[model samples]
Target: MKLIETIPENFEVQIQKITGDNFLKEKLESLGLYKGIKIKIIKNNKVDPLLVKVDNRRVSISKGLGLKIFVELL
Candidate 1:
C-alpha cells in the first residue's frame, strides 16, 4: 500500500485503510472516501490540493489528508 498523495495523476487505486481519528474518518467518508472504494487520482502535483474521482464525483483533498489514506494500485 502507498499513501494516496504519492499516487501519480491519472492512476486508479483501491482504498485499503484510513488512519486517523473518528472526525477525520467521518469527514473523508462524507466526501465519498472509504475503504474498498476505488478512486482515480486526477491531480497530485505535491504543490496543489490533490484532486480525485470517487464514484463519479471529483473531490479535492489536502495532501495531509491524503497521507492518511492508504491505497493499492488497481
Candidate 2:
C-alpha cells in the first residue's frame, strides 16, 4: 500500500487503511474515506491541497493528511 498523496491524478485506489488515532480516523471517515472505499485522484499539485472524488463528491484533502491514507492502486 502507498500513501494517497503519492499517486498521480486520474488513478484509482482502494483504501486499505487509514493510519492515525480515532479522532483522525473519524475525521477522515466523515469525509467518506475508509477501508473498502474507492478514491480517485482528480488533482494533486504540490502547492495546493489534493482534489479527490469520494462518494461521488469532490473533496480537497491536505497533503499532510493525504499521506496518512494508505491505499492500493486499482
Best by lDDT: 1
Off by over 4 Å in 1: none
lDDT of 1: 0.92
Residue-level lDDT tens digits of model 1 in 1-74? 99998889999999999998999899999988999999999998958999999988999988788889999999
Candidate RMSDs in Å, in order, are 0.8, 1.0
Residue pairs clashing in model 2 are none
TM-score of each: 0.94, 0.91
The TM-score that candidate 1 achieves is 0.94
lDDT of 2 by residue, 1-74 (tens): 99888899999999999987789789888988889999899998878998999879898888788878889999
lDDT of 2: 0.89
Cα distance off (Å), candidate 1, residue 37: 0.3
Give candidate 2's error at residue 71 in angstroms: 0.6
In model 1, the number of clashes is: 0
